[model samples]
Target chain A: MADKVLVFSRFAKSMLARFAEKFELLETGGKPANEVFSAAELADVRALLTMGAQPLGRETLDALPSLGAIVCYGTGYDGVDLDAAAERKIAIGNSPAANASAVADLAMTLLLGLMRRLLPADAYLRGGGWSGARPSPLLRPPRGLTNARVGVYGMGEIGRKIAARVAAFETDVAYHSRSRHDVPYRYVGSLGELVEWCDVLLIAVRAGPDTERIIDAAMLKRLGADGVLVNISRGSVIDQPALIAALADKTIAGAGLDVFEREPYAPDALSEFPNVVLTPHIGGHTLEAHVAMQDCVIANLAAFFAGKPLPYLVKR
Target chain B: MADKVLVFSRFAKSMLARFAEKFELLETGGKPANEVFSAAELADVRALLTMGAQPLGRETLDALPSLGAIVCYGTGYDGVDLDAAAERKIAIGNSPAANASAVADLAMTLLLGLMRRLLPADAYLRGGGWSGARPSPLLRPPRGLTNARVGVYGMGEIGRKIAARVAAFETDVAYHSRSRHDVPYRYVGSLGELVEWCDVLLIAVRAGPDTERIIDAAMLKRLGADGVLVNISRGSVIDQPALIAALADKTIAGAGLDVFEREPYAPDALSEFPNVVLTPHIGGHTLEAHVAMQDCVIANLAAFFAGKPLPYLVKR
Candidate 1:
């Protein structure tokens, strides 16, 4: 019999087809594991597949006595409780950097869309505002990408890609991260300094205790009236309430967001802002990205089942 | 006395303030010059400022007996009758390449917006479709930029910039232009070949007799069903009806258009397609681009008024 892999998160059925072909899947359909399966069935589960943004705490880990590995489906592994997993001696693996280019592409998409007033421009044209020769403040010329200062909030794979993409647009790029890497762009020591110095701040940092709610009201203020913010990272990295207040008072010019504090549930207040561009969290939701990520997942799972270390294991 | 400059196109008063400070302005507000000013007044005009897309024919040139210069406000001079200007000994001038970077940026914006399905994603989130778990084929995975083949249809400043921007995304860049240039990208011998080989086609060729309606139905068909098209060049380059048919029949995946054959008037047929991202001709409407073009216009007009050759003269 194939080794059983328990599905611990809500994923499209098609996304798990390959996994099912290779393993016996005890799919919970994003329900509580205890509610979906008996303790006897859970006792046989040796591995779990999960979305990296969903919380996988000690309680859930305790329920699966035979669980030896937890594999995250995407780049992030933040939702897994590292301390709990370490105590249980469970190996963790994630598809790091597999979706970096796709996420970076979306960052540029959001930044350009916000700065260019794309949503309003589309609305204006579709509503006959352009043909009627109606004066619209929304369609007024915005600052172009040339010579704009761009501050990247992380230096990971996604951040590096974002820097490279924006740099080609003739913008000055700088980044603030846990440690400076040997990237071509300049490195800034602090997030506050980076925010103050740049016209746009792009959040690509990993979410954890250190990064959660770091971009608070004070940070938003320093971004200034002409500044724009774009977040493709976890929404917890920014204080959504603070961001909403800053936009309300025009403290910042605009924002482009793919993630929210709550998934698939951005506050209604965000829709009211004319200066913002919001999308459902889909920074890495590309066909190419999915294939790359799936490849990593398969490799990790295959290694674990063969009694070898995961080739894409997440470091402690 | 200051030189008299007749305005042949509609312009915001603020855009003309600098010119007003240096010249005596006769603003026609985009009206017929004959109706806006008497023959005597027109005869006294030594220079005229116009949008490059508006037609400037022999009749208008003959009306201005002492017209020494025709200064186009933007990079394009396609609308100006170069033969008529030469016959009348009028120095034709334009802001060549002043808005190339801005236009190139928009080309990328439209390309990303369309391929990423930005509009449908935005609407899905804003309309609560995401929260409702409604299935949207529009939000399905798109072809990512990494390793994708990108074919540029022109080799001008804008096309080169587009190639550079897409290259940074790790795409395979190639181009087909009137003549081969010393660019780093691979040169395809024909437009049909470029279309066939690439996943995306970016149109950046100039608008003129030689290039009008070049992207007809057959070329689009060669682009294949998964291919995307982004046009930042003149709308006359693509057959609108053919594009509509191609889009309706799924000959192409999607399109992002910034220009149309008619000013400020996109067809109602275009509004029905969810796959396409449409914007008014605001490709070069950034503040920085406008300032650069204005500076060029001032330099060209100043040189003409000083009885010297126009600094930014359009070649005969």
Candidate 2:
């Protein structure tokens, strides 16, 4: 089989450079995304790779009769219709730790940036916004990471990695998980108690059926007004409305979020707050993650052809 | 005989909160920062506690006819005329390691941010930009802290502490100092050679009259384009024009600098690039540093009254 592959996500030219050497890769040409996914085009493809936060509907899955496997370009395979694929025995694969360090690096960056007001302050200086560039009293008085009580909710691969990085700052770390992890840090057995103890709370747990609305108003209240909250996991993992209200009322010091409740959409209330640092979910988007993910995709393809176990079989 | 004291820079309100428990402290809070003479203000005040980049000039020195001691609220005493105070047999004290971990914390944050372009991507996303939010092949992949070559420029308290932290990241650490530090890491004999070997270079050396413009354009290029340059030391330590030209021409890959050549001032050329991450000089501004600095100030004051040796003394 000459192995035809369809790519739906944006990636470095480097990935295509690799694909060109082997597979008959169906590249998403410079055509805008809305023009993609014509039914006639999907009929012959043997494999599909996609990303983002929505499910590729059943109709699209039905259209590709030759599709033998689907590779999620990055972590968070929430968009892939796993049930239909499972029924068809079409394999599904996701690159997990491939983007782990990248996302972990970004989470810490956002935490430091918000606490220090890095972007606004840097922009102020670069734009000549400062006559004297009088340092803000708020910026100067904020505390560093030493001995900070950092709470990690959802102790998974990314959370564990982030904990290791946070520990390097000499921060006291703890986590709330389905059960206690084998790690050495203090593990808080209860969710509310964990929120109360942490100076900074990061949401890295999976955002799904079990995790929806996990950090609601009551949890936000437990986090206290002096605390900072960082969410890079899933948009629904945080209750956006309550978070906005808390930030507006000074019930929380600040927030740094990568995922939003809605894509291409943000509450004006969240955007208006100077203390809240928001990103459009680019945490796992580093070049290092891209190439590693490419390797995993190749591994998955190689296994399917050999009739061996899939390297990263999606649980869902 | 009452003990007389002097203060250099203005102290934060938190200092009063923490230190007013003991000692009669005086601040230089008048107009004409130079005119806010620490020595003159503390003509009779028992202890002088000052902070930040303010100067302890001759007017203040001569005015304090009864002055017996001086205490700095921060790690640096460059602004203080230490020689003149020493000539008068004034006991000079400072807070060192108390503020070190905080600055080291920021250094790592900057290291991760600049190497990863955290702020620019966050800003782009929060501004309603979504195309770049997902991980794509176009993105550079993430690199782990495992086994990377990291260089430390200074061997002072902050540098030493940073070395300990860097080791936790599994980075092979090397350092360049005026003398070979006995720390566990490899000590490079020359600054030029250290730059050549390090994939990531951290500038943590103390700033004073003798150390200005040590890293000129030639040094930046030797690190090569793939190397990351981090400056947590004074802005003047690195030549501004040379760095700006080098960054603009792409001689180096990226830089993360907290202290700028002319702080409240950044290179106009740097603003155009997304790779560089800049912050207002905040290495020592964490809350932990603040409280610890206050403690150091208080300790120095206690030592002055008790006639004990001050922990940190400037070399004349």
Best candidate, DockQ: 1
What TM-score number comes out for model 2?
Answer: 0.89
| Model 1 misplacement above 4 A | B137-139
lDDT at position B194, candidate 1: 95
Computed on C-alpha atoms, the DockQ of candidate 2 is: 0.51
What lDDT score is found at residue B87 in candidate 1? 86
State the lDDT of candidate 2 residue by residue for A1-316, as single tens digits: 5677877665557667776676777766534323675667777776777773555757766778878888777778877677888887888888777777777767887888787777776676566654354655344467567788999988788888788877877888999988998987899988889999999998889767788888999999989888998988888888889899899888889998888888756776777788877776767766666677778877877786677767977876
Candidate 1 per-residue C-alpha lDDT over B33-81 given as tens digits, one digit per residue, 9 for 90 to 100: 9999999999889999999899989989889999989999998988899
Model 1's interface RMSD:
1.2
Best by lDDT: 1
Q: Find the candidate with the highest TM-score and give its number.
A: 1
Relative to the unseen true structure, what is the C-alpha lDDT of residue A305 in candidate 2, on a scale of 0 to 100? 61
- Predictions' DockQ, in order: 0.79, 0.51
